[model samples]
Target chain A: MKKDKLVIGGHEFQSRFILGSGKFSLEMTNAVIQNGGVEMATLALRRANVGGEGNILDYMPENITLLPNTSGARTAEEAVRIARLARELGCGDFVKIEVIHDSKYLMPDNYETIKATEILAKEGFIVMPYMYPDLNVARSLESAGAAAIMPLGAPIGSNRGLLTKDFIKMLIDEIDLPIIVDAGIGRPSQACEAMELGVDAVMANTAVATAKDVPLMATAFRLAIEAGRSAYLAGLGRVLESKGEASSPLTGFLQD
Target chain B: METKMDHMVYLDYMEQVDSDIMERVLDTVEQYDYNTYIVEDVKAALCKDKLDIDDFGALLSPAAMPFLEEMAQRAQKETRAHFGNAVSLFTPLYIANYCENNCIYCGFNCKNKIHRGKLSMEEMEKELQSISKTGLRDILLLTGESRHQSDVKYIGEAVKLATKYFALVGIEIYPLNTDEYAFLHECGADYVCVYQETYNTDKYEEMHLSGPKRIYPYRFYAQERALKGGMRGVAFGALLGLGDFRKDAFATGLHAFYVQRKYPQGEISFSPPRLRPFINNAEENPKDVHETQLLQVMLAYRLFMPYAGITISTRERAGFRDNVIGMCATRISAGVKVSVGGHEEEAKGDEQFEISDDRSVAEVLSSIESLGLQPVFLDYIRV
Candidate 1:
C-alpha cells in the first residue's frame, strides 16, 4: 500500500499536523512538534525576527518547515510587505495570508485575503490564506494561485471546534486545491472528524497551548488524525437511516 | 477629611499606550497619500463586492467624492444587511454639569461662569420617570468632568436609579479606573462611552491644558479599562475639528477595531460628534468637517465596520437627522436634554452644546417610521 502524504506547494509532508506557535514558547513548540510528529509550524512574522534576542527560529528542529504568517496586517498591501520580509529572513517561500479588519470577531477579510494571495503567488511565494469557510471565496482564492486554501473551523483561538464543518465539506467537495482546516479545532476528536470528512490537514494553536500537558495533547491529536486518515482510506461504512439490522442472520439455519 | 477626589485612584490605573498599535495608526495616516488615488481606484473599490482597508481608504479619498451616490448606496446596502432596517433610538440625560477640566472648546469648562448643578437623587429619579414615560428604554447618563462634584459612587447611584426605569443604561462621564467601572457595572451599567476627543496627542495636550483629563495616556485607554471592568459595550469617537478630521476619524476607527479585537465579546459603537460652539461662545465652529465630509466619514465607517452602532446625535440638524435615519446611522438620540435637571423641571445648569434637533420623542419615532425603518428602543433584555 502507498502511504498517503500531505503535499502543499510542491513540498511533501509526512505529518499532517500543522502546529501554530503563537502562544507557546519556542522550546515548548519544539517539544510539542517532536512528540506529535509535526512537519510544518506557523509562526507570526513578529516572532520570526531573525537577529533579535531569543529568535524563535533558533529553537525549531531542523526537519520542521516554517510557515510565516502575516498576523498583524489589516490590509492587502501590509500582508504583501510582510510576506516579502518573511522570505528575506530565510523563512523560505511559504506564507500564510491573514488579513483581518473586523477585530471584534477577528474575522478574516476574504476580499483582502484573495488580493494578498494573488500578489504573493505572482511573486513566487506559496500563499496559504486563512479564510472564512465560504465556497465562493475559496474558489476565488484557488483562482488567485493559492498553494492551498486554509478555511477556518471557527474564530482564531476559540477552541469551539469545527463549527464550519458543513461549509468546509462543501469546499472539499468543490475546490480542486488542498483543503486545510485552520483555527477553532479544540479537541483531538474534532480533528479526527475533519479528517474523516477528507480535509487535507488541521492547524491548531490554543488547544495545545491551553492544555495542561502541551506535548501530551499534541500526541493525542497525532493519534486521532492518523486513525481518522486510516478509517477514511478504508472507507467509512454506510449509516442506517431508520432501523438497526441484526448482525446474526434472520433466515433459518435449521428451522427456516 | 479624605475625599474620593483626593485619592485620584484612576491615576494609578493609567497604562502606557500600546506603542506598536499607536505607531501603526500614526504611520498609516502619515503615509496615506489620498491624492494618489484616481477615479479609477475609486471605481475599482466601489465595484468590488467585498471591501477591504484599501477600499475603505479609496472611498474616503477626494477622488471618491464624485461617486458619493455609489458609496451611499453600497453603505446603505451593507447597513441593511447587518441591521435590517432597524434604527435604535436613545436620549442623553446630563446629570451634572460641574466640570473641573479647562478644555478650550466646551461650554461646561471650569472657567465658564455658567450654572453648575449636580442632580440630587430626587431630581434624577424625577427626570428618569419623566423620560421613561416616553416609551424609551435606553438612557445615557452623562456629566462634565468633575470628580469632586460627581464621584464614582454618585454615578453608580445614578446608574442604579436608571436601571429601575430603563432597560439599558449607558454612561458618558469622566473616565474611571477598572475597579470604578466594575463598581458601576455592578450597579447595572451596561455601556461606557468615552470620546478620545482627538487622536492627535499634541493637539489634545494643547486643548486640554489642565486637570486629570490632561493625562493623555489615561484617557486613551478608558474604553479598555471599562471592558476590563466587565462592561458589555463601549463607544468611541474623535471630536471633529480639533485636529485633522480625517486622521482623527481613522484613528478612532482603528482604536475601536483593536479594542474590539481583544474583547470580541464586547459590543462596539462609534459616536462622531462635531464641534459645536459652547454656551456664551457662538463664534467657534468646526473648521472643515462639512456635511458632505461628515457623511463620507460615516459612510466609510459603515462600509468598513457594518455591525458597529453609529449614533447621529442632536448636534446635526433635524432635517439632516431625518434624511439619515436608515441611510447608515443605526442609532439616533431623541428628545435630548443636556442640562442637569432639565427634563422634568426648569433648567438648573447650562447646556453642554446647542442641540439642533429639539424634536420630541414621538416626532423622532414618526420620522423613523416615515422612512420605513423600525424604531427599536430595546433590542436585548437583561438576564
Candidate 2:
C-alpha cells in the first residue's frame, strides 16, 4: 500500500527513494531496486558509453524512472546542453540539473542553476535541481518549474550526513516543492531522520554503493525510510527542550 | 648579432617602453640616493599612515636589511588581513619544451642539450587525468617560446582542454599580440604569465641571444596586451638573478604597480622566481641571488603591492617555500612536471629544470596545512 505516492510530470511513482547509479557496478542496480524498492535512479550524462560500461541506461530495469544529471556542467549553457542530450537519449523528461563551477569546494552555483532551470522548464523537461541550501534560490527554482529541489546534505561522496540540516529544515518549512535530501548521507539513520523532518524523499549513492554489501545496505535504507515516513504520518510528538513532557500524566500514578 | 656588454648602449628595451609611468619608475631607479637616508627612510615608512613610491624604493635599499624582521612581521600581518589563511594550489603542465630563444639561464634554452617533448591531445588527457585524480582544480600550462611547435593555436587548444579538468586555467608561454591574446582568452584561458628574465636590458640581451624574446619592451608589456585581449588576470615576474637584484626588484615592483593602477579592475599577480640549475647548463654563476635577498625582494613586493598575489615556486627548497607561503605568498605550484607527457606516474621524460621540491600534490597540501593554513585548490567560479 503506497501511503504517499510521488507525482512528477504526470507520472506516479510508488517509491520516494532515488538510487544514484554512479561509482558502483551496474549489476547492483537490479538487486537494489528489487530489495530497496526505489522508484527512480539518477545517472550522470558524460562521454557516451560512460566509464566504458556501454550505455548505463541499458543496465537499468525498464520500470525504473531515469533522472539524468547535469554533473559535468560548469555553466548554465553547459547544464542545458546536458539536459537536452539526456532527453534526446530517451531517458524521459526528468532531469537533475547540477551547475557547479567551484571545483575546489564543489559547491553548486545557485544563480547558474536558476538560469538552467528556466531554460529547461520552458523546454518541457521535468527539472529537479541539486543545489546549495539557500532558501532564496529554492524559491527561484520553484518559479523556474522545477519538479523538486534536492539540496546537498554535504559535499558529494563525502558521506558526512546532514551538515546542513538547519538549512534543509528551513527549506522544508518554507518551499512548497518536494525537498529530497541528496549527497553526503552516509547512514540509513540519517536518511530516516531526513524523512522524519518531512522531506519528500531521500537519495544516497555512495552510502549504499560503497558498502561491502550494496543490496543488504539498500534494504536497511528502505526499512529506515519507511519507519521514518510512517512516524511523520502518525504525527510525531514535539521535542520539549526545557524538560521532558511526560507521555503519561504525572498525577495518574496509582501511588498518588 | 651581439651588442657590446655595456649596460647603457643596450638600454634599447628601456627606451622602447613608451609609458610615462614606466619612465618615471626607471627614472627613480636612475636618480634615487639609496646611500643617503636608507635606514631612516624605511623606518619612517614603517611609521607612516600611507606608503608612497619613495617609501617602497627605500624598502628595497641595503639599509632596510637590518629591519627585515620588522618588514616580514608587518608583511605577514597584512597578508593574513588580505588573503586570510587560504593557500591556493595549482600544478604546471608543460605542453611543449620546444624553444627558439637562447636564454642561457633557462633549461629550455635552444642551446641547452636536453630532451624536448610535446604532448598530443591524447597524452594531454592522460596527464590531466593523473592531475585530476589528485583532486586539484587549478592548473597552469607552461611552454617555451617556440613558434614552430607551441604556437598560439596549440596553446589555445591546451587551455580549452584544461577547462575540463580544472576550474581555473593559466598560461605561461610566449608573448603574443593583443589579437592573439584575445583569441586565446576566447579559447577559455583566464590568465597569461610572462617572466622577463631580467629587466636590466644588458643582462637581457646577453641572456637572450637570438629570438623573439630579445625585444625587452615587448616582453615587458605582455601582461598589458593580455589584459587588452580580455584575460581576467595577468601575472608578471623576473628571473631574479641575471641583473642587479635591487634595481630589478624595484622595476619589477614598479611594473606590477603601474599595471595594477592601469587595470585596477583586473587581477594582477607577481612571482620572483630564482634561477634553478639544469643539466649541462650551470644554472648558477658566481654572481647569484642569495636566499636573504630573495626574502627581502618578496617582502618588499608585499609591502609595495599588498593586494596582488605573490607565488613562491618549487625553485626554493620545501622548507623555504613552506616558510614564506602563509606569510607573503598566496599561490604555489605542486605536483609540477616541467616536461611534456609528464602525467604518467612513472614518466619523468624531460624536465625543463630540476625542481627543488619533488613532492606530490597531496604531500604539498599537507605541508600547507601543517603550517596552520587552509589549502585551496580552486576559488573562482564562472557564473
Candidate 3:
C-alpha cells in the first residue's frame, strides 16, 4: 500500500512528503517525523543553531537530509546569504528559497525569488522556489533553473485548507518539475486533495504543530497522502451527473 | 416621503410618538419575506409619514423591549448561523494612562489624583508576552486622551508592537486625521474603536469640558475618518449612563446606520458601556443605569441592526454577561484587567477601572462551552 518514492532536484526521496521544523519541541518533532515516515524535512536557517549545543541539526536523524529554507529573508540578497550559511553549516547543494516580501501575508516575492533562483542555479545549488500557483511564475522559475517549484495552497500558517485548488491543479498539469503544495493546509483531507490533484509532494508544519496530538496527525497525513497517490495512479471512478436506470429501456427500444 | 427632522428634534419627537406606530413597524418587519424587502421597508416604515417619532419611541419603549426580544432572538439565531456558536474574544491593552482630557466619567481624568502609569517599549513587550499566554490572538490598544504624551506616532508604535503577538489589532484611543489613521492601518491596525461617549450636543460639551475630545462634531465624525483611512472595521459605542439612555441609544444606532450605509464594504460593531462604579464616592453617582435597562438596550441594538456585532465588556457582572451572551451578544472580553501592567501578575498598585469578569481564558472557554457554544480562537485569515 506504500508507494513512497518521489524525485525532486534529481534526488530520490523514499518518502513522498516533507515536514517543517517550527512550533514543535525537538523530541516531539522527531517523534512525529519518524512516526509519519517522512524521508526528508525542511528546517529554517534563522531557527537553526549558530555555534550552539542544541541546534535543529543536532536533533534531526542523521539519515534525514536537511532541506534548509529561507523563511525570514524578504529579498534575493537575504535568501542567497541564508542559503550560503546553510551550505556552510553542512546542508549541502539544495536550498528552498522563500523570499516573501509581503510581511502581512507571507506571500513569496515572485520577482525576488526568480532573481535569486537564477543566481543560485548559476552557483551550483539545487534551488526550489516557493512561489504562487501562477503558471507563468512556475514556468519562469523552471526556466531560471529551479530544481522544483513550491506553490502555496493558501497563505503560510493560515490553515485555510486548499484555497488555490483550481490554480494548483493547473500548475500540476502544466509544470514538468515536481509541484510541492506548501502552506495553508489545515487537515489531512486537504493534503489528500492536493495529492489527488497529482502534486508531487506536500510540506506542512502548523497543521501538525498546532494539532492537539502532533504525532497522530503526522501519521494521518502520511496515510492520507498515500491513499490519494494510490487513487491517482489507479485512476479515479467517473462521476455521474445524474442517476442512471438499472435496466436500460433504450437498449430494448434499439433491439425492437 | 418621510419628513426630514433635525437630529435633536427627531430625538425629542421620539419621546412623544405613539406606541402603535412602533407595533406596525415591527409587524411590517416580521411579515416581509425577503431580506432586501425587510431592509428597505423597515427603514422606510420607520422613517415614513413625517419621520414618525412614535415608531422610534415605541421601538425603544418598555412595551417594545419584550417584542424586541423576539427580534433579538432572531438576530441571535442569524448571528449564530453566520458566525457559528462562538463568542469572539479580545483584550484591550492600555498602553499609557495619561490623559489631557477632563471627561467626567473616567478614572484616568488628568485632574484626578489617581496613580497614573505608562508602559515603555520594554514594559509593553512584557505586557504583550503576558497577554499572549492567555491564548488570545485579538487585541485592542487603548490610551488616555493625551495628544502630546500618547499621540498617533506613539499609538502606531504600539500597534506595530502588538502585531508580533496578535493576529488582529485595534485601537480605542483618541481620534486622528485620515492620514494619521491610514498610517496606523499601515502599521497593522485592523480596527479602530472611538466611543462618542455621548451624542447629545449639550451633554457632550458639558461632559467633555476640556481637551481635544471636547470638540463635538470632530469626535462625532471620527468613524467616517477611520473608514476613509482604510480600516477594515469600526466600532461605535456610547456611555450608557451619561445622558438619557433612549435618546443616546437612538443617536448611537443612527450613527452606526449612517456609517454602515456610507461604507458598505466596512464592518461595523456597537457597544453599550454603562458607567461602572468608580473609586470616589460610588454612592453619590446619581446617573447609574439599571441592569434590566442595559439588557433592554442590548436587545434593542440587536433588533435594530441584526448584522452588527454587539460586544459586552467586563463592566457587567458575570451572571448578567453569561445571560446576555446567549441573548444577543456576539463578542466579549475575558480574563480582563483594565489597569496598566495588569497581566504580568496581580495588577501593579495603580490600575484603571475594576474588571467584573475575573475568569481566566481557560475558565471563560469552559464556561462558554458549558453553554453549548464553541470557543473559536482564530477565525480570520489574511488570505
Candidate 4:
C-alpha cells in the first residue's frame, strides 16, 4: 500500500543500491556508481597513496556520499584513527566501522566493533557498523548510536550467499533502523533476494569486481535491486496452499 | 649437530645400516608419534649408514621411481597420521613484476620485453579484492628481484594490503635485511619463502647474471633473516632444473635440515618446482628436470624429513599432481595462473607461465574427494 524510500543519514535514495569502492578501476568504478544510481558507496581507508599517485580516492566523485570503511583495521583504535583520517579527507560524518579480529572470516569483533561505534558516534560521527548476523550485537550497536546496521550474509568474500538468512530476517523484523545486507553476495540474485526480504539496501564488491564483465554486472545488479525493492513495495503474491483449487466439476455439480 | 657418521658405532649390531633404527623410526611413525622422538629418530635413521648418500640416492634414483607407489603410500600414511589427509592450498599474488635482476630463467628478468605491472597501494587493494573472492585465505606475495621497485617498504605495503584479505600471508619477494624482515613481520607477514634457485655458488651466479639476487650467500641466508625477524615459518626450496637436480636437492635438503635444527620452533617446508615453459624460448634452457626426478626429490624430502611440508605447483601436469598428492606432497596449488591479475575468468594479458593443472577450485576439490581424500578449507582456524 505504501512505497518505502530508504534514507540513510537524512539522504533519501530512491534506489536502495549501495556500491562498493573496491574492484574496478577508478573510472570504471565511477561509471558503475553513476549508472547504478547508488546514493552511497563504501570506501576502505588504509595506508595507501591518497593523492593523485594511483589512489582510489582520486577517482571518487564528490557527489556520492562516501562511507569510509575500517576494512583493514584489526583493532578499535586503528579503526578510530582511520575514521578520523577519512573525515579529515572530506569523507563527511558517516563511518562504516569494521573491526575484524579474525582475518580469515573477516568477521567483525562484536565487542571491539561496538566499542569503536560508541567512540565514533560520541565524536559526532554517523556510525554504521558492518557486523556479523548476530541480532544481539546489532541491537547493541544500534543502542550505541549506530545509524544503520550491516549484517553479513556469510563470511566476507565467501560468496556463499545468505547463509545467515534466518538470523538476518529475524533482525530485520526486530530492528527499527535500516538493515543493510553486506558482503558474501556472489550473484545478483542474492542481492535481489535480500531486497525482497525488506532489506533497505545491499552493498557488494566481489560479485561485481571479479565478474567477467564488471560494468555489465554492475548494471545487472542495479536492475536486480530495483526489481527486488519494487516487489517488496508492491507486496508479494500470496503463497498457495496444496489443498486449495477453484474448479467447476460436473461430477460434483449437485453436491452444493 | 656436528657428529660424524660412525660405522663402528654399529659394530656390535648388524652393521648394514641399522634396520632396528629404521624400524624404530618406522615404529614411531606408525604410532603417529610427532614428539622429539620422531624427529630424533628420523634424524638418527638418516644419520645411520643405512641412510647413506647412496641409500638417499637409492631412494630418489630411477629405480626408486617404481617404489614411488610404495613410497607415496608410506608418505601418505605418515602425512595422514601426522598432518591429516587434507592438502593445504594457497595462491601467490605477484604484486610487482619490475625487476633489477637479470636471471636467465625468469619471465620477469630485467631484460625481458614485457609490460611490467606494479600495483600501487590502491591497485594492490584492488588486486586483493579481486583475489579475496576466490575463497583463499593463505596467500603468498611475490615480486621480481628489484630493489628499486620492490624494496622493503614496497613488500611491507603489499603485506599490509594482503593482511586486509588473508589470514596467512607469505613473502617470496626480494630478500631483505633482518630489520626489514622484522618490519614486514610487524606489518603482518607470517612466512617468507626465498628459494636459492640454485645453491651452487658458481651456478647461482651464472643463473642470476645481474642483480642483487646474484649474491649467493645473501639469498642463502634469507630464511635465517626471516626467522630472526620473528617469522613463524620459513620455506626453503630449490628451483629444480636450474642446475643439477641431485646437487640442488642435496643442498636444499641440507639447508632445510640446518634451519630446522637451528630454529626448532619455526615451521619448515620445501618445494621442488621444476622450470616450466617461459617466454623467449626460455623453456629451451638446459637442465630440464623430469617428472620422475621431481618425484624422486619429493620422496627423498619425505623420507629424509617426514615432518617437512612438500609443495608441488601447477607446473606439473594434472596426472602428476594427482599421483603426488598422496605421496610426499603436503601442499599444492590448484587452478593456478602464474600471470598477474589472473583471477578473472579471462586472462587480462600474457601469463608468466602456463599452468599445467588448469582445474577450478571446485574441480580440484572434487578431484581430491574422488581420490577418497577429504578436501578441507580453513582447517586451522577456529571459526
Off by over 4 Å in 4: A1-256, B1-58, B61-66, B282-288, B344-350, B379-383
Query: Cα lDDT for residue B343, model 1?
Result: 86
Model 2 residue-pair collision total: 0
Supply DockQ values for each candidate. Answer: 0.03, 0.02, 0.04, 0.01
- Give the TM-scores of the predictions, in the order they appear: 0.61, 0.60, 0.55, 0.52
DockQ of 4: 0.01
Q: Against the correct fold, how does model 1 do in TM-score?
A: 0.61
What would the per-residue lDDT of candidate 3 be over residues B147-193, giving only the tens digit for each residue? 78887888888899998887779899887878888999999997889
Task: Between candidates 2 and 3, name the one with more favorable lDDT.
Answer: 2
Question: Residue by residue across B117-160, what tens digits does model 1's lDDT show?
Answer: 98999999999999988878889999999889999999999999
Ranking by DockQ: 3, 1, 2, 4
Residue A13: error of model 2 in Å? 37
Q: Which ranking of candidates, highest TM-score first?
A: 1, 2, 3, 4
Q: Which candidate is the best by TM-score?
A: 1
Which candidate tops lDDT? 1
Lowest summed-lDDT stretch of 10 residues in model 4 chain B?
B10-19
Clashes of each: 0, 0, 1, 0
- For candidate 3, give fnat to 2 decimals: 0.00
Q: For candidate 4, lDDT tens digit of each residue in B177-282?
A: 7788899999999788989887655576677776666655566677877888877678888888887776677667767766766666567888888888888765
For model 1, the stretches where C-alpha displacement exceeds 4 angstroms are A1-256, B1-20
- What pairs collide in candidate 4? none
